[model samples]
Target: MVPGIYRPRAVDRTLDRYRRSFSAIAIEGAKGVGKTATARQRAATVFKLDEPEALAIVQADHRRVLDARPPVLVDEWQRHPPIWDAIRNADDDGAAPGTFLLTGSADPRDAPAHTGAGRIARVRLRPLSLAERLDAPPTVSLAGLLAGDRPALDGDSDVDLERYVDEILLGGFPGLRRYEGQTHRAQLGSYLDLVVEKDFPQLGQRVRNPDALRRWMTAYAAATATTASFEKIRRATTSNDGDEPARTTVIPYRDALRRLYVLDPVPAWRPAAGSLGELGDAEKHHLVDPALAARLVRATKGRLLDGASSGPAIPRDGTQLGALFESLVTLSVRAYVSAAEAAEPEVRHLRTHRGEHEVDLIVEREDGDVLLIEVKLTAVPDDRDVAHLNWLAGRLGDQVIDRVIVTTGRAAYRRPDGVAVVPAALLGP
Candidate 1:
């Protein structure tokens, strides 16, 4: 996490493999997720457009990027929007594979002229996952699970509930790893502050009252890991005088935050074949990282571990610790699934329309195979805990390749019922 030292990222392997065939690869993510660090490894020619002088130079001659060395890296390239079109044009001119690497913290307000679907590829980078942050390599493979081979689960993790709490507080951000205590909390707070003070304005969304946005964000954080209605979330942000922000005003704030990558919501899962009836259409709320959620609601280790809940009063099923833990699990699974070779694997949540059945995470492969997973804050999950996972497996039948429960346990093993119980730390791509 030190400035000079570079830690290995899951995206590193993807970038290396992709650069061989793709003419351009755009690595996109929220700020401080280490896009530049990862892209710089593959870049020979670098244009740090974030710098004022560099921006001026690029602004004057945007086409200069097309002539740079193979594997050109345009850091924070949104500073000059046309650079994307220039790269696309060069790709059309038969540019060789690995011709460009564009890294941006946010999408440019000025839209790209082309979708670049065939010309360029995109790789997303997120805050470090639980497996990425730990010392030991993970033993259980999410890729293996998606294969439907029912592989043996074997590994022991030293990561316990307290350690997970620590991770939730410290978060997966690369540079923020070195900070601890009040400094760490303050740094997280400051990061959120920047989103309000700079990122929103840069994205062309005016913040008339930063405090109101912050409160809404805090309420959204309180709704982490739940398919809470937007109206409910908005209502949670209401004032004592029974006044609420209008929907028209709130929609722009949500859209702008999404554009800034400040919000990472998990869309509800609906089976493509329509075998599962009437699925919920709501999205489970989450921030870019659980540490941000923790910071937004001011959740501390003791408060989270002791089953304390507070903040904007959004209704949810479990304890504050449990929701944040699910958020952490979601982050880890998302990071792993992105690196998996399962062919268009997606991370989503599943909830029946009547709320009779729901699972924390679902990795639905392109071929309709499902790896249904549940998250429990405890080290051990009883029958009641995995009931939904079992029910979904029964519903999906052969399509349910693997049913797993991600937990804070010390060991990774399979149950007699044929479900896999994995310590979150032991899971990898």
Candidate 2:
């Protein structure tokens, strides 16, 4: 029996809705995002491939596990990637909907022969959103915005800047949420350590110098929300002798990290059908979770409260806390947007070549309509805060479905020009 509380995930609804039509569904995310527990709730018989006994059985005959029951779950299925094709073959044999469920923490070392496109639907399960983490419910729905319904933006959350700092340090990992102080800090530290020491090697790329990899990771963490170039990060991880690893050497590290789902950077947005004048191609740096980033830079709540910044490893526009807040918002937006699968919006970042204008988050519909949002770590958003939103609105005209400034403010309201000002706590899926 799975023990402990199961906080309802936003993806639960999506999983339920999709499994009805698809034969299999794969829930993918970073480790410890509660993928197993969430899948267990729907599974009858589970094959935990990570375990020796279960793996031994699968090795003996892969079909043995499949014979246990229908609606069978194969946890850590990436451990034995052939199971993916086994399930795919089952689907090819006309298996009933929702017959097989697979959950993976990281991508398999060997890629599956088949893509499982039509037979198995893949849903991304990310960390908990602000609404899931907090007691008070969100007032504004992301789905509503995507629908262009323009619902009333009215509600309040006591989750201020200080509380946001607490959330940033606390992180969104379900199991680790209850820990505080040094214990919590240590757990996050160990999580990062495992990523470098174990997770990377498991993904088929052995780090010859773990220390160098850790430094690179720390430097990347320091980059957080900025679009800091790879050259900058390479220099930051320089050795004491002032020698840095070759760019060729560091390239594989990012590939490995990405495959492990450690880095979740937002790609630059390009309008599908327009000349938007030199949209930057660089991706905005972000880890899977903000707390992991905070832990990498050793950002304590007290230090963050004091407006302390991390190492000069990467150049940043504002404070680390602010960047983290944007990251937290990005996570929430992705979660909310993912849940709105019917009219799912593609979330990306926007930046010009000269860096004259930039918006933190862009939610673009399949039809190319967009909802632009700017995340601020402040209580009240004045005209200065909404300047970029205004600028983008002028450029995009009616193509801009909505403009928003997400802040740590108390209330959710809109300005005279129709740009919505929303508190992060008050926004939901």
Candidate 3:
């Protein structure tokens, strides 16, 4: 078992759900995102397939080895695809409740001839949120805010804007948490190398030129936090070659990144009564970690936070920071919703036909209740920031249950129209 550390409350919630349902749980995420550590911390007994001896033992007598340790935690189960069938068989015989907890950095689709449907309850684990990094002052809960509880804000301190930017640039991989200065940059570069050379090939993807993929990834990093059309990405990447890869190829590459738990594309959402044509199908691209975006910018560690003040000099038309801020907000909402066991909400970008208004995120609940969220990086809240959210509430009327604007500002307040303006720093799991 892994040594004791700060147990992620979110994983605890997932484990509880698995126990209640007698379901096999699969934790998927990027390399170095703490999957093994989190699983080991919770597992009764762990069998690590990465170790050669364990691999030999599992291949020699798969079922017997698993049965010996019922309720086993299999780390990197994707390494031996046949073990999945063994797990399914064990589950069928009712060998034990919560008999298996599987962890893998790769997706099941990438696994060699494995059927994981009946045996696994999948969970996608991303990097730590800004609140989880112990970077800024902590945020309050959305559940508390929705329940009409107003927590006291202890006013902002001497915020280390530079350090915060550095953290954002380095990302939330647990492996890069403690390094400082040039060492951090070196480690990040090494990480990118590993993702391209080692991780992608292991997932059964045949990349003729990893260099081209890396270039495309860099381009994506530059365009992070914007509504990116796949066609635009294809055009950019295919310029050198007369024959361009199809949208299908681009999607799998993106999915490979997602399965690694690094890339997340926020899709557009339309009201049930609204026409899908009116709402664009384009997805706003976001890296799972904002720091990855920062690396694409090639910005020095401290420049990310100075984005607004730095004016139009920065890339992506001065919207890079705002996009990262929006990505952060999206991640926070995803984390909160997942932890609360709320029905999986569909996250969408809201835009109108007239192009007069736009809202960053509209989380539509299973019960037809909508939670509208807007993201801003400014230290002071402005009415202009939430105009679309208000417009959405007015348009949807009774269909809207909660209206929230997550901002980088220090205070939390409610608008006269009942929109909750909150500090992004205060949002936590």
For each candidate, give its TM-score against the true structure. Answer: 0.98, 0.97, 0.86
Candidates 1 and 2 compared: the better one by TM-score is 1
Give per-residue CA lDDT, model 1, range 170-198, as digits (tens): 99988888998999888998999999999
lDDT of 2 by residue, 275-339 (tens): 66887889999999999988888888878888788754578888888999999999999999878
Q: Specify the poorest-scoring 10-residue window by lDDT in model 1.
A: 335-344
User: How many residue pairs clash per model?
Assistant: 0, 0, 4
> Residues 326-386, candidate 3, lDDT per residue (tens digit)?
7766766666655656544567777665456677877776777777788777666678877
How does model 1 score by TM-score? Answer: 0.98
lDDT of the candidates, in the order given: 0.87, 0.87, 0.68
**Which residue pairs collide, candidate 3?**
139-426, 139-427, 140-426, 168-291
lDDT of 3: 0.68
Top candidate on TM-score is 1
Ranking by lDDT: 1, 2, 3
